[model samples]
Target: MGGNGKFHKWKIFYRPSPSKSDETHRREPPPKEFICPICECLMFDPVVVSSGETFDRLCVRVCRDLNFTPSLSDGSIPDFSTVIPNLAFKSTIVNWCSKSSAAPPQPPDYSSVERIVRGLMSRQGGAEEGKSRIRCTEMELIDAVAEMPDVNLSHAVTELAHRVNHFYSSSSEESVVMTTNPPTPLPLATRPACLSLSSASTSDEILNPNPNSEDEEFVAKFNSHDVYEQEQGVVALRKITRSDEHCRISLCTPRLLSALKPLLISRYVAVQANAVAVLVNLSLEKTNKIKIVRSGIVPPLIDVLKGGFSESQEHAAGALFSLSLEDDNKTVIGVLGALPPLLHSLRSESERTRQDSALALYHLSHILTNRLKLVKLGAIPTLLVMLQSGDLAGRVLLVLWNLANCAEGRSAMLDQNAVEVLVGMLRRNEFDSESIRENCVAALYALGHGSLRFKGLAKEAGAIEVLKEVEKGGSERAREKARRILLMLRGREDGEEGDRDGILELGGLSRTRHRVGGGVGKNATIANSTEF
Candidate 1:
């Protein structure tokens, strides 16, 4: 995804605490005010309430008030309460814990189980375990305590959370710890109620309300008329794109892609084609990059391109284009024969699809320079077919320019006799349309750029004459690309070693070679052309 898919940088950060010497300036200045847990000053900022296990004491207090029991760590509340006083809860709890030295946790039985049992465990074991916890026949004593009057189990639950959160908030200083990953602030109501057993309404939490159900509903109801329309014609080749993203996403069992292979060719073309493009882009995303690429999904994309798709071929072509540039991606695309359909798309009626197709070819042509299987795969014929089409002058020019710009097709250019077709397009009789003139000049430039040897050949083949005509017409892009070709051919006439100086040393020669709308008399005339 990075430029040329070669070199990329990832940023990482390390936070080193300031040393003691610099602590005066860097350390968090001591809390400007007491961040009391009861007051909920800094909202779940550690309160440092008597640390070890104060919740056990609160549980005892509730049990005492309920006149029920602690369902103690080992015994009922009454029995556990007798061992510790209400005032000395902390010391008693610690001493009792120390004396008991809680037994190490028991491990689950891992002796060999039947294959069927293992499968059951894998599938339904979690549900079974939850059932066991809630309805165990052996825990009669535990259930009886749930009936406790003063307990108000909901209040106790809220109180316990409040006390725990309150205790922790008071534990840490009230300084803003500026970090990309500082702990998220607890909800105001939850934080305060969590500390000291308060029941205040949560302003932040209550206001935001249900986030998902409403979002899902809104997303469902949102207008998809636009999505449906967008997926029509050339864009409709991406129908499966809107099918999953905008319209069908609202369906009960919506899918971004399908596993049940489409039944009809039309279905496959509509859904699979867009899916191919979607999968390609998703493969570029940071979140989906690893999963998508590793899943080996590209083979199907390559298949679609290779097999061909008249309705949605561009999607596959574009995807294949991108995949060819990526590491390990070209293997499948190459095998599935990605080049043919992409070439077809360049001659497509839809300009958008053709552009994407051409762009992919250009990208493929510019890579590593050793992937000549693309060039040998009849890329020249397909490129010329698109280039020779009268309707595609602009697009054809771009394709030719890119082809001639790179080293990938240099050898193929000479071997395939591409120069003659390109030179054939460099006609000067009809230079009235800026587009035709520009395309003519571009084709010449592409031919001239192949090599020093080709540059002279291209000039002799009338590339230089077309350049003079286009420049005479004042087409800026044509003039620039054309001027470069003229300078390159002049340098080529001289030996490659002697004076390689080309565009840079054109100051004196420009008066004769570039006279805009007029000829420079005999000075710039070629051998066969009369100096009229």
Candidate 2:
């Protein structure tokens, strides 16, 4: 069986070449679905725009930057308002490349895509008219593209193209067309208020008299039977909320929230991602955080966290993290059962998802009820595994710090052999951040409040030796925590009945109780006050 296993490995490593016919078949061009609409090449990072069209991410960015839209074969203009990573499609392309023994596509160069867009724009007018038409200087065009943001560039390009087309359609005999200087760009604070695209407008000019009119339009589009309109509404809202805090405040009404709720779970990747991202933006406003939580948005956000598109899951985790920052939303979020899914997200393939999940769990664990729930949900073992794996060690340690604050949490940590893992990291100097090391010692200090089992565990894990070193060379916080933990460990090892005073001392309690000879008097108070 061992020889057969080795033979199979060898066969996989050294396969024979295919015949001419098979080679010819394997070398066929990638399918149309894999080809980017703008560059007409196999997409390296295919992303879905709000129009439900897939294009390379770079192509989309370049087109948006140049203020030129690709004219698709179907003669439809894609909505470039939002772009969401089509991860499943990208994965399929990768698998096809592997099976066919074909090289995977690389990202198209920016200059190359820019050149293609320029060619398309030039073709918008007749070839003869191109030579006769007065054009903006190349340097001026470069300066305009450099100074403008994506939205401004789109509007500027559209306006420029409109002027050129109008100029050519006229029968005026004058040859020299004096180009007026472009208007000075508005400050960023005023930019979002003036965004007026052909399909969408974010100017709050009508918001005062008819507040719900704009929101009503978006909600109508959001609830439409047409998926493209739904995508356009959500994407526009996403962009608007991201740019203007006022829009975030105004658009977070219950009616808009209700309209957005279903799209959070939409089957379309672009809609789902942008919808959740819009929620994240809404949650950023301090006043909107609790409003969003109370609007029954937490459940769908949790659903997205569980099984939505990968990009949407990242935004969902971010939204939860943002919401969890509010004191009132913390317990409510935990009650909505965000803990398990959030704990699962700590292992997500996306680093942003993992980071946000860890932070959300950390904030939620601040409440005593939530901490106990986390212990019940088996978070200690999962976190310990992630910590040992050295993924997001600093952020993971922050969550562990919160988990270590409760009795059930401390007990769970000891049972999961957390001491060995933490001490192993400290002894090896595994982390470069002093804050991470301090957090490690702080977690150990919190666990020191446990029963004699912690002492045995600490001794077995060689924690005392490591703590002493931390005391000598670590930060002031690390040294202080290490000092207290060392005192507790020695006090326990000394076997003195009054050593409970030493434990109380580690809890920052007065040693006046030393003469009391037992920990019965203020043990509960000490335990409660000393939680990290």
Candidate 3:
């Protein structure tokens, strides 16, 4: 990224050997060190690497280029060790010793397969040797393993896919482990960690060990069966970087994301939010989102949003909002305990953050889905306080508009005097006259559709007077809208009486309110109903 990302003709390099006939063909100086020969940089401590061929980052271009190769003639094994040599170490040392640097050899265009393979085989870590070096993050290591000879990167990735409950299983593991790559050999304590790979199934002794009450002879036999893994010196929770972009990793072998979880549960706000955002990015897939929501992470996630700084809060809020959109995650936050943090974000200093929070709350309150949750979580009052801020008015209205999409939302809107506040706004033209007014009216219409309560409140609050005046000389759209509202009101001014006896019902209501929905129907006794 630092050097010019320009492409050069393929100056293919051939290994020079003494046996070649010089008369028939002269050997060149290793093709003029094609493709930079080597980046004069430090190797990852105890490790050295080089790309036998060069390919651009994006995998699409390689296919078009005839030079790129996706598979070997056999496609049976990887040819990295054969086709590509780790020659960068020697070349880099040579370049550094003699400062007379020449332009790196330009290589031929990469073929499609080459591009894809190169992309799949991304090279990381050409670090300076002196300074503290970083450990490859779980992803970096995974990418390395994926690119290795004979191993199918895609297949390796799929081995831990969500289909086999891998997502849930992984989430349930140590968070620290989840955060990094895999288990690394830490300094072996007196009672060091013994590792084993239970890729498919485990032995009887490991899967279900006998209780202490079991016969000692039987238990002793099982104890001898414990598997010990290859132990090598490894840094857990080490920084993962390519000398420029850096990430952190916990271990090297078994699983990432699950490894650094312990560190993530730090008391520091930045630490918590950082951990959550990293996980959030990694959990971009649907299964990941679903698994996290179900894993008991909502509380910690909420805490980060509620207690962290503006940026951290924003990150947490964004993560929760993302989870709110997924079908599997929609109800999980509320059920799993993410409500409070979401409400907290509404009052945040950042506008984008507040908007996202409001949007999440809006979705949560869709009809009867999480409307009760909204009320129970005390979202209404927070939503109201937010409306007081000029910056929040637009988003507040947007949320209201979407919430109105559901039947229970409409009912709650009318029951909570949501009608009263909205009517007051319309009566005095409190919001912006164009788009704001349109959105407000739209919200009112949705609420009124479920029950005549909204219509009655609007009339009594003198909203009708304002609507009538606006309709008198207003645009055709405004006039048509007011006329319809009037119809819904059925000329009633008091909510005690309605034109029709339609019941817009939800399960959770006050004991006195009628229960008219399926699922967890409880008391809908929340007097602050409309507020949240």
Give a tens-digit lDDT track for model 1, residues 1-532: 5788688797889999777567545544323222211121221112111111122333323323433321223321112212122233333433443454422212212232123233433454455434322211112322222211232212111111122222211101121111122122111000111012222222222122122222232222122233222122212222222223222222211122222111111222332343344443333222332233333344344445444344235455544443444434433343334456667666666544565566555545443332366566666776676556654454444445545555656556656667666666666343324544555555455555537668656756676676677567645665765666677777743222211122112111121232223345444321111000
Q: How far in Å is the alpha carbon of 527 misplaced in model 1? A: 57
RMSD of 2: 23.9
TM-score winner between 2 and 3, please give it.
2
Per-residue alpha-carbon lDDT of candidate 2 for residues 267-335, written as tens digits (9 for 90 to 100): 666667778877876776667777787556676678788887787798898788877877778876876
Clashing pairs in 2: none
Local distance difference test values of all predictions, in order: 0.37, 0.66, 0.41
Candidate 1 local lDDT, residue 208:
23
Choose 1 or 3, whichever is better by TM-score.
3
Candidate 3: C-alpha RMSD to true structure equals 25.7
Candidate with top TM-score is 2
Q: After superposition, how far is residue 34 of candidate 2 from its true place, in Å?
A: 59
Q: In model 1, where do residues sit more than 4 Å from their true spots?
A: 1-294, 306-309, 318-336, 344-355, 369-371, 406-408, 428-443, 449-452, 492-532
How many Å off is the CA of 173 in candidate 2? 65
Winner on lDDT (2 vs 3) = 2
TM-score of 2: 0.54
